[model samples]
Each structure stands twice: as C-alpha cells, then as structure tokens.
Target chain A: MKISARNQIKGTIKSVTKGQTTSHIQLEVNGTIITASITNEAVDDLNLKPGQNAYAVIKASDVMIAVD
Target chain B: MKISARNQIKGTIKSVTKGQTTSHIQLEVNGTIITASITNEAVDDLNLKPGQNAYAVIKASDVMIAVD
Candidate 1:
C-alpha cells in the first residue's frame, strides 16, 4: 500500500529487540543504523527478521524541528 | 530541553503554517524541505519564524518500517 510519508529509505534489518509491548528494530542503511520503535504486534505481523530488506517510513508530520 | 529523539538534523525554518489546533512547520535542510506537524501551542512557545535556524527532531518510535 502507498503511504503519504515523504521519507522512505531502504535498509536491511540488523537486529530486532522485542520488549513487553514494543520492539526496537535496527535497520542498517549504508553503514548507518536507523532505529525504529514499533509495536510488538506489528513486528510479529510483518515477520521481520535480520538480513531482510525493509523501508523506513517516516511521516513528515512526525518530524519536529529544534533550534539551538 | 534535552530530548530522547535520535534524529535531530539542523535546518532553517522555511515557513510556518498555523491552523486551528495544529501547525505545519517547513524546515529546509540541505536543500530539502522537512515538514513537521506540531501543535499550535508549540509554535507559539518556540516562536518559530521563517529564515531562522532550527532542527528536525524525530523519535525512533515514530518511525515505521515497510517491506516490499
């Protein structure tokens, strides 16, 4: 399905750390690790595993800007 | 204030569109416009304006992953 999020970078699953209600998925993209925190149920539904390719989907609205 | 978000990219405020409850903040980072949906209260608190330097903060939990 198509999403409205502007940022969608391709990466491979580096690791998956499951917590009580959430899971932290480490995605390795060009030597950089982008961490994504998703629900444990979503992780199970996606059947995400290490060495699998995935896309990091981030909504523009979710992004916040800070000033120093 | 210190935040837990890992992704905090420096940028400049390109524009600020305020709505009734929410506001759309456009931050220009390296020629790319990163849109942020924040509350109108935040805009007022931060006093965000155009051409001002800022940062785009994104939490890992807010990030999602998709597979092809």
Candidate 2:
C-alpha cells in the first residue's frame, strides 16, 4: 500500500492495549519504545501483534513539539 | 469520518510544495509551523491549500523523540 507520510520507521510490535473505543500500541524501534493510539478496528485490520514488523508512518505536521 | 490514530491537532494550511511523487505540507498550529511530507496525490485529494483548516492526525507509534 502507498501512503503519503515521509517518516516511515520500521519496528517490531511490543504490546497492544485495547480500550473501549481506542487502543494503545507499543513498538520497539532501535530500542525506543514508541506508543500509538489507534482505534480497535485499526488493530483488527492491521492484526498488530508482538514481534510483528510494522512501519510507523508520521506526517510532519502532525508532530507537535511541546512548548513551555 | 472517524480515524483510529490519536494526537489530532487543528491548524491552518500554510503552504504546499509538490514534488515528483511527494509533497511538503506546512501548517501553522498555534503560531508554530508544523511541516508534513505527504504524497502528491494526498495533496490533490485533500485539496490542501493555504488558509484552509486541516487536522494533523498522528499515530503515537510514529512519534519518536530524539534523544542525545
């Protein structure tokens, strides 16, 4: 599948936490644990599991640097 | 439409630069310029233009904080 985002980091799924309407997905990328909050359907569609290889697609605009 | 990923931020389209296969999208969120590198098709499909309001939908898994 083709996507628009530029940052696609390859990693392995570390954990999946399902909530009522959303789910938190954790992946280990170069020893960095990145968490993703997505919908249950996304989890079901992607069939995300531990040890599975996945790409983290991020749009630069979506990234917000916290300012103090 | 409902999306799965979390970390959605509202902003205005600042500019759109189209390349051969990709495009660079810039957005102003709370006076901060956030950039997004997406596909040219995504830009066309989304009709992203300056002064337009858009949402930066980010999946947490894709977010990686740089550390020293």
Candidate 3:
C-alpha cells in the first residue's frame, strides 16, 4: 500500500521478537539498527522474516521535536 | 512529558516552515535533516525556533516496516 510517511529507510530484517499483542522488528540499515514496534497481527499479515528486505515507514507528524 | 517512544534523536532546529494548519520543523541530526510535521498551535506552544537545540522524538509503534 502507498503511504505518506516521509522516512522510508531500506534495510534487511535482522530479527523479530513477538510479545502478547505487539512485536519488535529489527531492521539493519547500513551499519545502523532501527527497531520498529508493530502489532502482532500486522506482523503475521506481512509475514515478515529474517534476511528479507524492508523499509521503515515513519510519518512526519509522528516525529516530535523536543527541546532539552 | 515522559513518553514511551523508543527513538529520541537529539538535534538542532534548522528551520520552521509553517502552513495554514501544520508546520514542518526541520532538525539537523549529525548532518542529516529530519522533518517533523506538527500543528501550528503546537509550534507556538513549544515556541520552537531555528538555531535551537532540540530532539526528534519518535514512537516505536509509529514506525512501520514495509516490504516490496
């Protein structure tokens, strides 16, 4: 599906750790690792597995800038 | 406010472009620019301006991993 999220980092799936209702999908982009927490239902629907290519989709609004 | 978001990237405000309803806040993080789309009210509430130190806060669940 087409999305409006601006950040789409291409990476390879390193691992998938499932919890009760959510899952953490680790993606290795270049040498950096980005962790994505999604619903277990989405994980099953996507059929995501290790060594697969994927993109980390992040919406611009979801990104909040804070001053320390 | 203390949030549960996983990714909190520290950066400097590079620019702020406001539209009718939302504003795009650009942050320079280690030479990379991360854009955040927020409401104009929020911008005013936060008083975010250029050349200020800030952080790009991102929730883990909001990050979606996509496959081709």
Tens-digit lDDT string for candidate 3 (B1-68): 88787777777999999999999999986676778999999899989999999988888888898999
Docking class of 2: incorrect
CA lDDT of each prediction against the hidden true structure: 0.87, 0.78, 0.87
Model 1 stretches astray by more than 4 angstroms: A6-12, A28-33, A50-52, B29-32
- The sequence of per-residue lDDT tens digits that candidate 3 reaches over residues A24-66 is 9988866667789999998999899999999988889889888
- Model 3 interface CAPRI class: medium
Q: For candidate 2, write residues B25-57 as lDDT tens digits.
A: 898999999898787878886677899888776
TM-score for predicted model 2 compared with the true structure? 0.52
After superposition, the stretches of candidate 3 with alpha carbons farther than 4 Å from their true spots are A11-14, A28-33, A44-47, A50-53
TM-score against truth, every candidate = 0.69, 0.52, 0.75
Clash-forming residue pairs, model 3: none
True contacts kept of 3: 0.80
Better of 1 and 3 by TM-score: 3
The per-prediction i-RMS, to one decimal, reads 2.6, 6.3, 2.3
Go through the candidates in order and give the C-alpha RMSD of each one to the true structure: 3.2, 10.3, 2.8
Ten contiguous residues minimizing lDDT sum, candidate 3 chain A: A26-35
